[model samples]
Target: MNIKSVNKLHYLIALIAVFTSIEANAQEEIITVKKDSIIPKKEESKKSEEDRNVMLNAANNTGPREVNIGLPASVGGIMIQENGMPVVHAFWPELPTRTWRQSVSLAKPGLTKLSEVAITQGELGFAVSSETKLGSDTPSYVGNISSSSFGWIKGDVNASGKIAKNLYYTAGIYANYDPQSINFKFTNWADRTQIYRAGLTKKFENGKGKISILYKYSKSASITSHALFRYKLDGKVEEIDGFKIGRDNYMLPNGRFKYLDIKSGEYKWMDAGGRDNESFAHTVDIIGDYKLKNDWNLNYLVRGRYSESVSFNIFPTGMTQATPESGFTVKETGEVYTGSANSMILSYTPRTPLKTFMARAEIKKKTDKHQWRFGLTESLYSVDNFTNNRSFYYQAAEADPRQLVRQGAATGNTDADGFYNYNVGGEHHNGFDNKLAVFGSDTWEISDKFSLSYGLNLRWEKLKGDHYLTPRTPGFTLADGERTKFDHDWFHIGGSISGVYKITPSFGALADFQYTENNGLLTSYSGNVTPNLPKTRSPLMGLGLYYNHPNVSVVTQFSYLTRNNYLTRLNLVNPTNSSQNQVETVYYDIETTGITADIIAKPFKGFQLHYLITYQTPVYKNYNFNAFGNSYTYNNNSVEGISKVLMEIDPSYTYKDFKFWASFRYFSKQYANLTNVLFFAPRWETFGGVNYKINDHFDIGATVVNFLNQRGVRGSISGAELITDPAPYNDRLMVGTFIRPFTVEASINFRF
Candidate 1:
């Protein structure tokens, strides 16, 4: 056998042996591995059942299942798709599951409070979904999961009790931290997102009603993208390339560096700034519930939130490709920006700060034969933001951008006056966009077998917001020819009507016909033309059939989605002057449809298996826009970032506290960019693990991930707009991200 193979085999065998020996020793004691008892029973049966069901679903770690943070199962190894974003038009099984955080509807404020009761009565838990966890030092075990480098996850804790007669109190906290990955294989960034949040909720009831107050704080260090940089031997390289984009190409001076040195080595790569994303958000909320005579209940909520991206003068990282065609010159073998961060920021944001307020009220009536819910919601959103960006010119024509880093390297870019060369060519607009919205919904349980919910929403954009402007660049005055006032008024309507039908406990079907049209500043730029405003309009529908039995579970679903009047922003090289960039706006209409099938089975004792697969077709129906003194049209093309087929398989077994499992994740080959220049090969990863229950109070486990260390290229895809529009309008590229190499991690748990 090859030396490498033999070495791997030895480690694998050693791991398995160590785990088996420990478990065997614990087995001698004859102790059962079960959840610790945490209840002092009263009417606890229902609560216990709910907890068990949630735990079971969590263990599966598949679609619609929420990850519980407090459990050892949450740390790492979460099977995440699209890096860390919600699936577009997903399909689910017949059983009701919380696929994603349900929309926080102000009308159902009380329901949120009631759910917390379960937390207090049970164990503390946080759903670490949509975010990466962290790295580990040991081989993995059966339940340990890996985390994603980017995503929004919620961490929370709750407690409830009776402070006095007819007086009850409840408290909770919700916090989350976005997982930030140190450069993998190289200094190239693929995923770099930072988020910190802490929220406090207090609820205390009196004779009049139940009242709750909430306050939250949020901070974001930055949001950056890993660019697909061109690899060459020389250039005015601003940063040393440590790794290759979307591949396991080791770029450091030495051999492959593991996560071990990452914590200490991460800062060294900061010289090349990715897109800087710094922002803050503050929120305050008040909600209350009151019970009326008979069987009626009412709920009301008032909330206000303020948020803004920190204004900056530098992009730090290049806004686009650093290829020669983009004006950037590097003399080293690494990544550089073709475009300056300053120019990009000018085109992205024209506003300073943003604010929002929401108020809502809901009422419900329940009887033996019928249950009805009705509610209304109103909100206001506004933004006032702008930007200033300049360029730093290089004076040393003798310097090479591609030169690798030198310990004592001295930059020779100082001008005669010891001042830096600063060039100005960016956009600037001073304006405010305010939007008002009102919505209402009704939910009716018509019968035991069928139920449905419907809602309507209205939005008025730029109703009464102030407008102003400055020159696109500093030191330049705007003539009467340049339009600066960006103000307009428009209205939109949206709503949804969805229903469920159940034939039996084991058989059911679901159908949802939903459409939404809204207007707002969900963007960095607030420069809307008075006569031409951008709005978001999306319509989606889905149908599913499921059959559930004691031994086997099966589900099939089909869904269709369309995005029209979607907002598309672009940064373009100014045709009037190649030295600068021109920000452009375009709109496109898109359509997509897909089907998913899943099966979970327990063919025999001590064994379980799950299989899921999906097939999809996403395409751009039409794309026409005018920018840089030219109008262009793109023919129908398969939208980038969407794969035709994907699947996952999980199998596990347990025998008297000794457990083992294997999970497989796979995706078909796909186009990394819309134009299809960058191709992404099909990729898959496998993880094998074993867990040993070392006598009830303590346990240890080990896991081997990507044991084969398949160096497959994989990453998120984007359209040409991410760069300059129409340059390669039909193209797409996979940024810096790849399947990790074969690795092993181990962990232990203690219960008191």
Candidate 2:
């Protein structure tokens, strides 16, 4: 064998040896792996008959089962798709998923969170039904409440039981007060959230059919903040000299903001400190399953949701030198000429009311050697109305920044509140979209040691929208313009093929290949006048191996993916002239290759370690674009906002009824600007928690986030998209988001 092949074989042998040794040493003792409700593995057959019955009962009551397309799983974002559609649309404003129970697999490991939910080409588009536990046959109740050091309180309560023969029900409520709902600091904004949900299940007398109905109501109000920072010469995003990373922001002291109401043609006040952005949503779901003759079964689901939300935000634009010649006067206190820099403040608010409906039906048949499924899915998403408003003013760049009134003629004379009559009104549109797909898959058990699975999905989609084309001028009104219509439709196909081979009972190897194509939805077209958006094509290939032992388990995977026709919007500014700027829409492509290793080990009694490492190279390709008639080409630049290396190490110990765990996550440097000019330094996030079981009915726990006190700046830097050189920005401050500061939370839980 070649040297490289020999090296790989040696490594594999070493891994097996390590795990085998652990298994042999622990054979005298019993080791129980954590039960993951998501994965349905072959080992489940080893469970007891009563356990099997419970599992079957849970499935019969929880509506349709989740759809697995032989893909690798990931975390975060809309990893869970319901009926071939995302439960929450990625392009729209939505609330957090604290109360949402679901899981996700993105066809491959080590994919970025953005790529996980982008709904682009090559994705499996797997369906994971959001089934509530309300219809459980066993009676259970759980409640917990927690308060954070950051002055936030959160609590939840849930109950499930059997009400009558073949009848089950579940109910729950959740609430949070002044929580740090967003990535911004809790001290920067005020927020609240509440959710109420209930479900009922019924079974047929013949035991062959079942149905469940679920309802949910949720309401939330939150604020997102923008913070200013400076870029160091070494390409590090640093907090301003006196500004704190997480404890300080640019919001008004009392959280009050004044802006123009475009529809009413008058100025209005917004309470940024309290419920600045609000959302209300209602959802209803119906699900059914029936067993048919000849070993065939049918499962179906239907869901409808009505939601309305409004978001208001204020952020800073470009910065300029602060001087008397700049003609700056503080509007709030009538002071003049201060600070080393200044920037224009912009306000944006959008109100969206929408309705969505989805349906799916699948028929499955199981034979001695083959299992087959055929399914159909339909989704209808409509935006009843969408309206956005905007306003602009200027502000001094300093802690507790003050609004400035321009006394110079260069910038138009300002009103008493320092308001400028610039782009004060915003666009409006109404959208309607439909998607239909027919899919089929089969799993062939070729032998006890080998199996193959393949699936295909044929899809047809239509997007229709009516937009008001009027410019966002001062005093703009919805009735002042005529609406224009745009309609587009297309057909697409996607499929996946995978196979697994068992080298031994405890060792296995697998490979998967997938390809898919996608296009822009209503949200992508709403901001532009043209209906034609670029289509994207993505293809992914992966190879993996897994080894399981009595005390240790390891999974390693390698993936290569190439996706073209990425879409993004950039706000570009002239390097020599700060006043010369424009917003441009750009299209680019990316090629990524990654490897991941996940390991779980239990070296001794009541002690476990979970470790994961991912290394990836995601680079730009054909990234040529024009801004303000200037052509720029960035062929092999690293993709911005994504780290190349990520690692997670978690260790836990359980003694008696008490448990302790600590987790450490590390991230490599991440580029902040599209031009690859500035970047954020590598950082670490530490979390540790301890829990005590105070009996079968009560438990208490405490956890801390960012326990290492790493006040690092993360995420993309706003207003720096066009900066190719950082020399000019050394003295000027730019705005960027930051990681949460250190905070601790304690909670008590009870169950009956």
Candidate 3:
């Protein structure tokens, strides 16, 4: 049936239930009294029979048994119950074995209930997911490159439940495994890694207290095979003294390597060889919580972690390289070296507003015409530094002076124990109203057809950080000739005001204004400079219309924002004179306006649709300067202007013990920059899946993502000038060398 018919039917059912309940209540209240003075034993029996008949009729009229269809076992929306309460709806047998339930029970006065527990109730479930990449990869310029194919598998098993009415517990074990191998022409290498985690939690006192413990471990090992070719030259002709050319010499020049043959040549150049590295990490955590009363709570948490890694590169002292095709001898290299390092991280979060230390007090009261609630809170946060160490390797010949005789000479032996260390320390504080302030509201009953609501929010915050860096050897210094110690402090106060007026039950208008003032110290010891933004301020305003209904809502909003310009500098010392220095400064300012529209709808059962369109124009003004006295500035430049539209549709259907769903998303072309010279094309994506229950204890499913075979690139660049190169986006392109539509998943669940 159509949506209208379905809605009408639901209304009719609700009305029937209401009328039936009223009639049942009236029948239950019926009381029969007899004139006992003249009543005999037969009269009393007749009265008793009438009472029994009335009770029977009342029972029949009370109501029908509510057949609650449990929520979907997986991949489905939750249902909202009457009075806006959320109720879980699941398919029987397919529901997740582990579930969490929270509730508060009333108890006798003075004796407060204090049970707090997080419980996971479910049967045993194991799931595995994996992904693999295939190709002969190329090296990356930024860091060490691994040209190989790799894949990993992850799985977990979990169970939780309440042991008693007030105590709860949950435990789970997770594991991950990855085996990767790489092939560089004839050389090949492989590595196997594994990690595991286990955790448990216990809760007590109606739910007033909780205790939890967790542990994790990880390890990996790698093996490799390597080879090298050598070549020899004799005047204009290259040849091996005791070798005969073989079929392997397919691409060799006729006279370049005609003398050397593979059959009689000494196997001087064997496989280059491989190495093995092993590493592991372990972690432990403990946490506890306590509730003092209905409005107060406390908690504590601590964690510790340890990690180590070691590696050894194995190789022969002397190995000769040969030509790619012709087996001509070239040069011999020396033995290889290996190294390793161990690192650690320690951190703690104390009791504060965001943690355990902070507390809030709230007072709530109601009057015939208005209601009010006020609350106050204070909080603190802190974080420690992160540290790491690394070891290096060196070859004997790498330090040899003979290498200087060749066109190029190898640098001195690498540091056998080189490492870099750095740390970051910071803390923050926050104080603000716990709730939005409300002054007045318009109501249809008190006013015309218009209704409105106005509210305010206020917040204050502070942040400070001190960062340090120390390099190996000579130790580094900032370009400004200053020691490597940087510190800064920032503070801000911001708030927003919002109001809404209803034109009709389903339609409304809204307006909101936000403003913030930020002040911070800009210090660069290296630059020996500081700047201030005492007048820095940001403001935003929005106006919109909202249409809301039982199954759908549409919103159209226009917003504008403006921000101040801020500048900072970086110091660099001159090479010729330590006292002479050069500095660089960057300045920024921005303003933007946007119009957006969004729609949410559920026109069919088990389905939802979403659509959004946004148009925006953004302008930026910037200035840059270098020590060479070169400076450039762009004033009120429209850096980017774009219009975008997005549409998403998801539909689901359920049959006897089976569920199916499909979704599609589409995007319109987006323009960048006021010049409108650059743009991105529209893209589309589609996904579909099906799941079926084999029995009460098991089910299986499969899903395919990106079924449309659509591919594109996205990225941005910023510097002295605008960058238009597409390389940033190219890295994200899908080569489509693999299957167009790729994915297959299956699972089985067991409950006892």
Best by TM-score: 2
Better of 1 and 3 by lDDT: 1
User: Deviation in angstroms for 406 in model 2?
Assistant: 2.2
**TM-score against truth, every candidate:** 0.59, 0.83, 0.45
Worst 10 residues of 2 by lDDT: 18-27
Best by lDDT: 2
What is the lDDT for 406 in model 1? 13
Displacement of residue 475 (Cα, Å) in model 2 is: 6.8
- Worst 10-residue lDDT window for candidate 3 reads 111-120
Query: Model 1 over residues 624-677: C-alpha lDDT tens digits?
Result: 777556776654665554456767687888899888887776767555444444
Q: What C-alpha lDDT, on a 0 to 100 scale, does residue 689 get in candidate 2?
A: 84
The lDDT for every candidate, in the order shown, is 0.38, 0.59, 0.29
Ranking by lDDT: 2, 1, 3
CA lDDT, candidate 2, residue 238? 65
